[model samples]
Target: MGWLIFVWALTACTENPVDHDIRPPTTLEGEWLVTAINDEPLTTANGQAGSWLGFSAGAEVVRWEPGCAQLMFLYTVDSDDFRADAIRYNVPYDKPIFVPSKFMPPPCAIGWPPRLEEAMEAMSLARKIELTQSGSVLLSGEGRSITVRPR
Candidate 1:
């Protein structure tokens, strides 16, 4: 009788915790190389908007292995948020380098809680990192997606 009660209590106490499948940052810590990026189309009031420059590109690729550079980007994962993580570039450079010639003040900036508060307000609706892949991770909100890959 006591054994049965003990087993029941143990089972009741052992309800699996919330699914935290998004493993910790041990494996993803070091450098990561960006292989590819998918640029989602932008929509305007009229319809699909075209770029003034007439060309579009996604995240930049950097070298991972020494003396042998491929279509990969290497950056240190300074912080990890299953929802909204960040990676500091291995090579230090100014933000201005990313500015487009057509834009006066530069259309946007990197790093979270972006330069605009309004955008964050809109992004608040998206799911906060339910899961992460081995080589890739995603942050989706306000219909915008940011993908990260390993080096």
Candidate 2:
């Protein structure tokens, strides 16, 4: 009986070979550096470049510093694709709503409220973000792409 079971296992293994070279998806749970954006090499008018990006594995939140603006959004994931909605909090603006202040969150924050949503759309359209196993390619519906390496 044991021999019969072993034979079945052997047949299964022979029929479906395993690809041991494949690694799992990268855990996009920590900090990611802004290597480049919109294919322009992440430059800044004020010399404050290459913003930081953060992802919270526990809350499905994405923290982005596109320039000097810190924006937070709740994103929905379908496989490797991500769909993020309106900015939940515009760090520099959201916190200063009631005050007459000229304070900004950080240097990474940039863009006015009028154009911020557009930026969000552009960012999200890169629909899918595949990590280490796939060499971290960002694919957009309009054929635009962004590439990032683990930092």
Candidate 3:
């Protein structure tokens, strides 16, 4: 019996090793920075910029003005791919909402109401986020791509 076990082990070792190097999907779980946020102008005066909000790897959050907040995405793993629920603020207009207000929840006591609520819903139904482990590339909804580096 022992010899049989040894023989099986030797055979297994001679065969190809399992492909443990398979790449995993991108999860944008940690902080991410905003390089750009391009949006067509609804009107000549109300043109919006890149993402309304952006987040750094740690906790540095940035919001674009005259535009939506940059995206500060925190991902949740769902089977093979990763999912995130991020909210974009309406620049300075909604910055006050992020502060502790009389009728707001602890986490969002100071943020804007309509924008935050709308973003929450939009994020849920937003397109899928994809990443390549090797290069840390971020794929946007319209197939737009960005290269990400770990901090």
Candidate 4:
């Protein structure tokens, strides 16, 4: 009789299970490589947007890797919302340089927020992060989708 009551109480306690999935960062500092934006790769080669996105050409690929240095993006999290700002870090002479040509389409075409001054205005619009069952953190808003894998 006591065992049955204990089992019932245990089951009742679990009626509303707690979700311990997502947690904040202890150290969110350092540049996290934007591994993939939407479904397009941020790799050095083939820096164009995926065809499904229908973005026009002149899409520049920004690399944070050793050789080809483009844009070093900075990210910040406020509670659940986060923003990634593009910072033009001076590159070593040995590495490939990124020159902003006037005629080219803006960085936003390639899924980057924008440079410092403009990015500040852009960052003002906070976007929330959603955690998936597979443990991937999704940052999506304003017709943009990014899958961030912190490096």
Cα lDDT of candidate 4 equals: 0.42
Using all chains and alpha carbons, the TM-scores for the candidates as numbered come to 0.26, 0.44, 0.30, 0.39
TM-score of 4: 0.39
Candidate 4 residues lying further than 4 Å off, grouped into runs, are 1-21, 24-36, 39-63, 89-99, 102-126
**Highest-scoring model, lDDT:** 2
Q: Give a tens-digit lDDT track for model 4, residues 16-133.
A: 2222366633223433434345434444436552212111111222234332223444556666666654454443443322444443333444443322222222222337555544
Estimate the TM-score for candidate 1. Answer: 0.26
Q: Write the per-residue lDDT of candidate 3 for residues 1-151, one digit (tens) a residue.
A: 9999999898666312222255444354454433222211111225542233333433322221212333344545443343444443443444544343344334432344223433333333435443443334333344332333232
lDDT agreement of model 3 with the native: 0.37
lDDT of each: 0.32, 0.46, 0.37, 0.42
Cα RMSD for candidates in order: 14.0, 13.8, 15.5, 13.9
Superposition TM-score, candidate 3 onto the true structure: 0.30
Better of 2 and 3 by lDDT: 2
Kindly list the per-residue Cα lDDT of model 2 for residues 81-140, writing each as its tens digit.
Answer: 656553533336444321224453344334443333433455556665554233443434
Put down candidate 1 lDDT per residue, 1-151, tens digits, no spaces.
9999998898666322223565534323435332212223323346654211111112322322221211132222223432321123333343322233432333224322212222222223223332244435443455554333443
